[model samples]
Target: MPTALTAPAAGAVPPDASPDVTGSDAALRRYLHGLPGVDAVGLEARAATLGTRSIKTSAKAYALDLAISMIDLTTLEGADTPGKVRSLCAKGANPDPTDRTTPRVAAICVYPDMVPVAREALAGTGIAVASVATAFPAGRAGLEVKLADTREAVAAGADEIDMVIDRGAFLAGRYLQVYEEIRAVREACARPDGSAAHLKVIFENGELATYDNIRRASWLAMLAGAHFIKTSTGKVAVNATLPNTLLMLEAVRDFRAATGRQVGVKPAGGIRTTKDALKYLVVVNETAGEDWLTPEWFRFGASSLLNDLLMQRQKLRTGSYSGPDYVTVD
Candidate 1:
């Protein structure tokens, strides 16, 4: 069994950090700009190198199961229905019904209005209900509206809130605005019992336009109390990539080293194959160490990826491909 390390409590700050770093816009800008620049070629090279690593057959089975457990089985669509969410919830709880021993997913991600349905369906399953809020895929709403969105989800029994930052503000260098918005959303995640839903700040990395910007966004979100810094909304043209996910993993690893606060990293979007999932697991283990190997500190924001993982898992078990028909259609 993997020993779980407790991440820094939500909203906890580094003991020796300077107050001025997050105190003012000028200070935040200077701090973010001062951080080391990314070496694009080197980063891509390293990610590609890590992706090529091969695990033994026994290790591959374990990796497949771990990858399945880390998925935030999701359904975010205009056409989503109650029955669809219920089906997704059932799939999340029992990924491979034939085996009866498959692990449940980390969470069931849906829109705010679908939270109640998901919560009800996932009851007693020990799986989290994660809702995408703040005008998901685009953080274009006012703070009040965003907070209301977050609070509504929490009230609806969401265990986690995946909120998008104002990419417009972030791109314009309005660092403090983005930081304050995240803090407000974090507060809004609070329930009547006082325990707050975990907040995952999505950066939508593609629009950010540069590795440096993504790194800055990662640090900024972490500074403002993000429990997880995610890459992409999976709605954009360019979503999660090996280089981008690698960058986020490096950010979380360094953040923990500096603040004793272990933040999680979620790579959402285009990852869909068993091979792709295994590559990410390698990157996480190699870049962030084994402390982040569990579902508590890492997750794959994917839907179709689950089916592929299941098929591959069955193949490993029986020495023959089960084909697409072996898994349920997503």
Candidate 2:
């Protein structure tokens, strides 16, 4: 069984760490650049090896259900309507209407304007409502706009906020600016009741252009009080890949070891099948241990991925494949 993490506050720095690490731009830069470099060849090889490991029938059943529960069913299109959000919410609440035994998804992710719709539709369902803020796919807006976006979502009953970091600032070596932006956005996720919404910081790793940059971005976001460090916004040409997701699993594992604070990881975009999702789950188990095997610590930010999981699940139960119509069209 998967266990919950009882750790310090999200913003709490490591007890034994130096204050200088996040004290200034130069310190943060030195710390980030000082970290060990990623071996591209070795990372790809290891991910490939893990992807080849097969699971038995019983374990496969458990994994399919787990994967279903870990999904963040999403719809972030410009033409998204309230009806669409509600339909997506219904699908998330009961992935396969024919099988009440099917697990509910972790969350329903949508644009800020659709938060109320999702929240109302998922009421009493225990499914989280996650809104993409901070200018979403492109973090190009000013800080004030970003904060307002976050506050609006929280005010409208969003349980989580997915914020995008300014990749331009990050690449320009303005590390502290990016850090402070994340910190400010984290502060804006607070609800009226004093409890804050969980913050997932998106790095858009494809724009980052290097494995080392991805590592630095992961640590930088975690240090700035991110509840989850995500790989992409799912809008980039390069979304989630096995090797990059593996690298992120390693980051969360090491971060918990260093700070005694566990942060979740979400690999968004391009993950579309039960086979692909299983590969990610295998890497999570092997890299981060069984502790992160739950929906609380790991998530798949996907839309169509749910349909495939439900189809495979039906196959496992009935010993035959279900047609595409077996699942709802998202």
Candidate 3:
């Protein structure tokens, strides 16, 4: 029986600080429980329909550029070193060194400790430095440790803080604990100037295992003040998929319609090729509309996908087949 904290109103200027939480555990649980259950068969069918869309050559070229810009060029490995982070930043700032026309990625995501290294590497570029916090990939730490992880990243100059929700709590039906953790992390994202670090809440939907849990987690994250609802940590067996991502898009769309606050979506892991990336764009285009097509509202959390995109771009321009040797692997 946890109590709701007073947070900033929904869609307020400062994304992090306080959340516009619904109510007590009972009320919030009741509200979430009452939301429409997902139709798995119908959802899969719709996703399949969207996946089959044929993008013209010209449109695909446009989508390739757009997809590159919307990437949260990520490196979240335990073996991640400063050299590795700098290399990733270089690639993110300029994917194709040969072509100056190539747009930079939206941001460079790294571990909290490496925020400074990434920040230094990406300095003066419009590309942002994002850090994964909340004992990332596990979300098993206590709330204080999680908040400290987030605060340290922000203090180290991370422009964005990607936090993981306590899936254990959510799965156990302790929704209030999960909700309060997001609210607290949102508060930690606040800067001294009244601005807040952008917060992206990761549900690790692979671990959640069902479309219904994914939908519920999506709403919970949005309601508790997530600036973006990310699909996975890219660490589990079942990372981002077409159906799961499509369901997330639907959640963001419905949330915006219901509350007038727009939240972004990021689909990470297993989206390795240009075709898979384009299918996601199609989902965003049709489900969330053109407004969400921009990087401000959409992102792909990937590492190898960029190299593939660069190779494809080269082929599109040179009118010849390209190989892995043509692109730099970050």
Candidate 4:
């Protein structure tokens, strides 16, 4: 059995109001089960309503730049090489080499083994190196191996850790086990200064398969110590839809209302164009509100999305559309 870390008192909300869901497994489970359930049709309808927002001219330009800055330019694949990571980092550092006005992306997300390569490549550029850990895309490994994965990334200077939750456990009614894994990964993210690398917990909502499960997983992750609650690993088929992302936005927004500590939201997978990215911004704007607009609070996990944004950005500046050949293949 995994030994328990000293958790906060049960049902105790500290004066700071940070989420204090750490307690006996039974207590935590009760708390999670007691939370209200989600209404799928209502939720999807609301998301569709938010998606109808129209952005234009200067507003479009601002939204475009904001979207660019909020991107977690990603390259998560078995085929990832050092040279590929280096190239990705450079693109993230200075997205538009021809136009200096282009803002750098929020971070460069990669596998644990590639953290050092990305860290070195993005050095002094204020761009963070984020690594996917805890048996990313699938959280099927033992606790020890998962922690080692997180520690290796942190040791390699990963400014952020994106850890996936154990979907199988959650589905099997092992909620406490899922929460405990997130808590353990959170502990592993700690740095020398007592501060820790930002932890983004991927819920794998596609697998969770219901609005209720996504909502439960969001609160569960936040309670366990997720600084950011993400939508997917981008490896699954139903990756990041407008309705799903909106649901997560609502989760973070409500979690803040209940606990003073704010959490971020990242919608990974299949968000390919500037239009799709903008609609998500509309969800954040209309749902999570303006406060969630910054990179610190929200992110889009994508690689090809960057090139699309660049093409659109060029059209905005040059008054002409640019083809795929004009942008870097990263």
Candidate 5:
């Protein structure tokens, strides 16, 4: 069995955190393992620190969630409006209609059903087609169902698959159940040429409050062959949070330290501003370093975030902040 490394205490301050961690690594670890509230990671402090940074550059890249309504076909219909997506992509993926073009976003996420639409719409462009499969939002189905879902999506030409873990099974302590599902999904993603769709496993951290559980979930998912371990599905109330992300990054750090795997990290859901996006980037920087900066390792699954980043980028290029309606979002 693998022994747990000595990390900062639960709800305790990180060594670099403003508030000093209170005890020996072992005690802190135990405290963290048992609780659902704050661990050595000070969420408020981290959020504030990230907020203070000046994000006045066009250097940052983003990934847009065009098809987020997994269960609602009605919403999915307009999720990635080809005209809007084309327009957005043309304008450096700027969500604000008023801004000029710079460069396009790294990828455009959508439902597997809409892959053809996004592919045709974004053809001759660098933007990729990311599909959400395996009964997302509420993955309550069986492996066969999920496998068939995954296989069909990949066959339809999906470059990536963002799968949601079965919350009911995971919450029931069935780690292997969750692990096997991801493994099967990945296998289904592999094409005859041996190439595979990028596999991003959603941990939905807002639902799991304990740092240990988050870390455990990350490791298990990575071990089961997840290319990226994401934060949330954006369907839950308590979506992505800094502390939860910090914990996941620590796992990524540890995983890399032990096995040299360069897994990705994504913080999705409710990140409505450029500031939040920057803070997430800062956390990724602090935890996983510079390697995870690109679209390959990092993606923000947001509908409203791109516009804010665009607006901020525009303000830097131009001279003033745009209005609430300044950005055109459909």
Candidate 6:
């Protein structure tokens, strides 16, 4: 998604009124923690007060939010990304494209190297160029090197920089160190003109896999100055689950309540169908409320998922699938 649109903001009305689904909170709470295949029990008691206003205003919503923050969602899907980019582009995939007939995502997230390609492809289009830099996918490099990569990507025209945090440092309980690293990277995102590209810190939540871990990570990331806190790299087992998502949403809410700063949340990875997409939408709706409904605050990092969403949308409007191998490339 475009950082300009979804980056965390500290100012919102924090409406004092409640949503219309006054009595649904309890029911919603029951449903959230009782989800199949995963345990929502620990979170069930915490998952309370959900509704349109609540979801729009929900500090604790029901479903998980999809962080399709990738512009090049599948530019590197298989092993041959360049080839895939060319092939998909040939198949009508917008190297940089958007439209009402097509599936428009939050941003054209791509690798730093592909930023220029995406830039040329999306030039003049409203979609922003989001690149994964700062030693993305594994953020294992040195700080200077990471900062340089960030500079290069931004200089190359990336509107957003999706950097992965040092999982080792985080897991080791070196929060201050992790916080400083993220803070430094965020600074690099700031241009000489004082404007800055948005920064999304990938928690790679699959590895953390605990509500407490997710909560702790959320707090650190937001405090470290992340525009958005992401779930995974879309390359892990526990990518985006309802339970983990609940924790993150609560983290965002608690953070807001504690700091008066409204940080954004992005549940990336493993989302591949409209049904799942809708579920994520439900999560965002119930948790963050309509306030976070826009692309800025919400995103789904998916490649196959877009096809499903487009197919479902087509089906909903016309009552028929777009057929197999259907993807809104163009």
Q: In candidate 4, list every pair of residues with a backbone clash.
A: none
Off by over 4 Å in 3: 1-19
Better of 2 and 3 by lDDT: 2
Instruction: Pull out the clashing pairs in model 1.
Output: none
Find the 10 residues in a row with the least total lDDT in model 2.
Answer: 1-10
Name the better of 5 and 6 by lDDT: 5
**lDDT by residue (tens digit), candidate 5, 26-67:** 443343343334345575566567656654344443321211
For candidate 1, what is the lDDT?
A: 0.90
Ten contiguous residues minimizing lDDT sum, candidate 6: 13-22
Quote the positional error of residue 185 for candidate 1 in Å.
Answer: 0.4
RMSD of 3: 4.4
Instruction: Tell me how candidate 6 scores on lDDT.
Output: 0.63
- By lDDT, the candidates rank as 1, 2, 3, 4, 5, 6
TM-score for candidate 5: 0.77
lDDT of 4 at 129: 91
User: How large is the C-alpha RMSD of every model relative to the true structure?
Assistant: 5.9, 5.7, 4.4, 4.0, 7.8, 11.0
- Whose TM-score is higher: candidate 5's or candidate 6's? 5
lDDT of 1 by residue, 141-199 (tens): 89999999999999999999999999999999999899889988999999888799999
lDDT of each: 0.90, 0.89, 0.88, 0.87, 0.65, 0.63
Model 5 clashes, total count: 8
Clashes of 4: 0
Candidate 4 on 95-135: residue-level lDDT in tens? 98899999999999999999999999998999989999988
Model 3: number of clashes? Answer: 0
lDDT of 3 by residue, 1-330 (tens): 334433324333222222365677776666566566778999999999999998999787899999999999999888999999999999898899899999999999999999999999999999999999999989989999999999999999999999999988998888878988999999999989888899999999988988879987888888788999998999999899999999999888877876788999999989999999999999999999998999999999999999889888899999986899888866
Compute each candidate's TM-score over C-alphas.
0.94, 0.94, 0.94, 0.93, 0.77, 0.75
Task: Give, for candidate 5, the lowest lDDT window spanning 10 residues.
Answer: 66-75
